[model samples]
Target: MRKIEFVSCHRLPERSFFFRGKQFPFCARCTGIYVGYAIFIPALWFIKIDIYWALLAILPTTIDGLTQAYFNRESNNFLRFTTGILAGYGLAGLSDFIAYWIVHFFKYLFVN
Candidate 1:
């Protein structure tokens, strides 16, 4: 595995959660992100939205992460997972924003 993949081992095991008999690929927060991306990317077309909606989604995760780092506070796996979901929701919005711009750029190039 790459160094990046191995870095998960460095996280606080007290913060890690397990399922069945095996360890998840990542901790709860990362799992939430994965689940969120899976859900939100496809949801863009069904929902009417702008980038700010995504920013709202990201606020919890950012605050959690920053508070943990800056204040040395401890948070639970559930909060991490929920906040990760928020971040993932925003990530999807960011993707949609990028796609919108890309499509318009191509339109500008070919039609103009």
Candidate 2:
């Protein structure tokens, strides 16, 4: 539980999902994000997505979270989960992009 909490706030019981009356370790949105990562990480090797498009994919989550945090707007679990998936995919793509460039940079610097 501590390790899970290290990665997620796990705050706000209402935002979490429960099974058999046991709460999930992470919130619904976080669960979706992790699920997205699981879906996309393996695909990164075959799918070459541009960082710009990946960043664009993250916009919906950013907007939704900001709106809810600042304006006190209510958000449903479905919306949160969907947006989290998008954000997670985008984040994975961004990480891939950065790692690719860094590796190339080092190869260029050392191999050339």
Candidate 3:
């Protein structure tokens, strides 16, 4: 089954944090991003953010990934995942912040 194959591919060492766990390769932050998005997007449906500002917050991680990909240096998976998680959280926080600002701005413009 596809699930079995996926699990087998990410088998970690016995000492690893995710040793024998279902979610391997992805650390706490990465897991947080995936789980957070599931929760946050619905929240954003009732609230919205400036898309550009959110993108700006996510830019650093994008740059890091692109640079790492294009360069010839061999980096380990851990560093890659760390950067990814940081970027994901940064984007999430930025989205939330922008959404909050937009809501406040609308409240001020309409109510005041």
Candidate 4:
């Protein structure tokens, strides 16, 4: 952004966009990731999508990243953001899965 004071702003200027001559706080991918996680943190409580589904959600992000890294393919911000969102969902779901299993394991061990 114009402010250039924030850490993320400085770190990801190329990845960010300039609308109305104002730079975004983070790159498209980062924005999507943050937004997705923000959405997931709260909504995750209500939704019970399985870990396999979560892996499916994360697939796109991994593919995109791998292709870009190895093939040197160019990409747009919107796509980056989209992949980030998918990754974010996976990240949240995986975290929930781990936490859920851990709690259950302790409960089962201690209770029995």
TM-score of each: 0.85, 0.92, 0.46, 0.81
Superposed by TM-score, candidate 1 places the C-alpha of residue 82 at a distance from the truth, in angstroms, of 0.5
Tell me the TM-score of model 2.
0.92
Runs in model 1 deviating more than 4 A are: 1-12
Q: Count the backbone clashes (under 3 Å) in each candidate.
A: 0, 0, 0, 0
Off-target runs (Cα >4 Å) in candidate 2 are 1-3
Error of 4 at 98 (Å): 0.7
Q: How far out, in Å, is residue 25 in model 4?
A: 3.9
Q: What is the C-alpha RMSD of each candidate to the true structure, in Å?
A: 2.8, 1.5, 7.7, 3.3
lDDT of 1 by residue, 14-109 (tens): 666787865676778887887899998889879845789888899999999899989999889999999988898898898889889999999999
User: What is the TM-score (0 to 1) of candidate 3?
Assistant: 0.46
Candidate 4 structure quality by residue, lDDT tens digits, 1-112: 2554555533466777778987776788777777788989688889976999889988988888789889998778889899888888888898899999999999999998
lDDT winner among the candidates? Answer: 2
Off by over 4 Å in 3: 1-60
The lDDT, on a scale of 0 to 1, for candidate 3 is: 0.56
